[model samples]
Target: MPQWSEQTLASFERKAKETKVAVMVTGSIEAHGDHLPLGCDLILPTFLAERIAQKTKALVLPPIPFGESWPMDVFKGTVSLRAGTLLMVYHDVMKAVFRHGFRFILALNGHGLNTPLLRQAAEEATEGTDGTVIIVDWWSDLAKSVRAQVLESPEGHAGEDETSEVLAVRPDLVDMKVAKGARVRTAFRVVSASHREELLPRGVYGEPEGATAEKGKAIMKKAEEELLLLVEQLEQGKLPITEK
Candidate 1:
């Protein structure tokens, strides 16, 4: 798993000739309750991209760290990119990746809100470059199949799912003593977003009480396998759109 940022110019050129696509992991800087790091959105995707690139032979580019973090910013220390700004950054990065001679670009996204903007960047790539780009909303795209495997009760901001993921990355970052679940008074969704703390005074939602590093490893394995298969097939000239 070579990091594009660390490779020499000549090394990059040589490696670019070896791979057909580059994988870009994108996430946001936002609060994830009191226990989880604001980087929870970014760290997991970066980890996945590094793992996936080993088998995919795709270059793992440095992750884009800012995303749509508004509303959540009320929690403090959260930074957000306006949707238009996010789109421009993604588009520019993809264009540069294409210019590097890769014909396929994979955006492995950890933050859900960035999906639409990433897709817009993909559309830009489709229309503006000779390369093809794919945006995978890492959790949402894989959750269906994985839920069957892990059997968690829906997702929350810094709940079991996210906490477990981070635990798998660094157990030291998690403080289970202070972790707690939320009280959902209704099934009704709100039209106007409330400050995150208003919803869960503890700054966390869902019961992270059950989270374990083992579950997190299983979840990540499932995602990495899917990503590896897709990249392998894409490079074999058997991209999804071309499959019979």
Candidate 2:
């Protein structure tokens, strides 16, 4: 299958007549934990995008590796773009894809902080173009299924779900020995707070211990299944597009 992008002129022309549903995966260069790599967010969605493309025969766009990472700004290697800038980036990408004749666009996002921003971007993209934008936060989409399969406390930055996923994808990157202890943060609304350091002193939340590669594999598998169903629904015009 062809990867989606306006840059690929030949492939775009070849798939021009085919169903024009493009999948763009977005992630970030941020700290996962002591055990997981900084690019964990990027890798997970990229992995999912590949699986989704294979299942739906949709063109996969290059994953965006930078996102809004203000909470993890203290951590080394955490790179973040402003939320406004990130939204503009998505808008431009969507416009380009729509210009290439794609009527359906999926924003397969991996980062948690980018959720609200992407939501806004997707709405804007849809309004600005004739193409439909479907936003999918893999973890959020399959959270219930993941919780049913993984027995660990699923609450950290590099917590159970994330660690398990990384272990499943790239075991060599995880330091099992360092993946100990739990860092629980007091729950507070970000809307009322100006200082993030007070809430997350260690740049993490939840328990990191109990993560396993098996659990990650199970979570990923469930995610793929859900995505396939979603794609089918979208193709059949069953998925509802709501405005915010």
Candidate 3:
């Protein structure tokens, strides 16, 4: 399927008339340890969305690169949007998409902190439109399967799993020298307070040295397969949600 931005009106109209699903991928600009680039989160969802477009013949919209990153604002170079503002942004975008006559929306998200805000936005969008929105946090949905396949530790926020994904997508963007001395932290140990200064001084939460492009490719492949399966189910009107 052609990306929404790249397609002509006729092409888009044709696709919309044939299959009424539109996918929006989003991510954040946050610190991802010293090894990975700040665009790590942004790239993953965008990459997966492109793959999804290729697999499911769905129209892919341009990704929103900046997302909720308040928790990691302590780190230099982290760009964050307030949760409320992001939610409204999502709502407006979703409404516009729905107004264009798409009846199905898949919100492919990569950042962990953006989950709650995205969920809220999805709820509001669903309430306001006839379209069905599916918010997908790729890592969360595939974490169990990834961990089972991984040989190293996996946790959220610049962990082994994320590192592996970056390795697979853009190896040149990674600095293995910096990842060599990376430190790991646990969410359970850090969530008692909102002060990241006292909790994670290193800006990382899990081991990243064990990441490899091969492993990343495997994980991403699995994720794409699972996403296609979900898309097929959604197309058949078998989504697992009970509306209020």
Best by TM-score: 1
The C-alpha lDDT values of all candidates are 0.80, 0.77, 0.80
lDDT agreement of model 1 with the native: 0.80
Poorly placed runs, candidate 3 (over 4 Å): 180-195, 241-244
The positional error of residue 43 in candidate 2, measured at the CA in angstroms, is 0.5
TM-score of 2: 0.88
Candidate 3 RMSD to the correct structure: 3.0
Q: lDDT of model 1 at residue 85?
A: 92
Superposition error at 70 for model 2 (Å): 0.5
Which digits, one per residue and each the tens of the lDDT, describe model 3 over residues 170-227?
9999887788434544556455335775455556777787888888888888888888
Arranged by TM-score, best first: 1, 3, 2
Give per-residue CA lDDT, model 2, range 1-244, as digits (tens): 5566543666667776666578888999987767789888899989888887677767788899999988777777889999999989988898888887878887888888888887787787778567788888877666565666575675557788788888888898889897755564456656323565545544556666888889889888888888777777766755555579
| Clashes by residue pair, model 1 | none
TM-score of 3: 0.89
Estimated TM-score for each candidate: 0.90, 0.88, 0.89
lDDT tens per residue, model 1, 78-120: 8999999999999899988888788888888999889989888
> For every model in order, what is the number of clashing pairs?
0, 1, 0
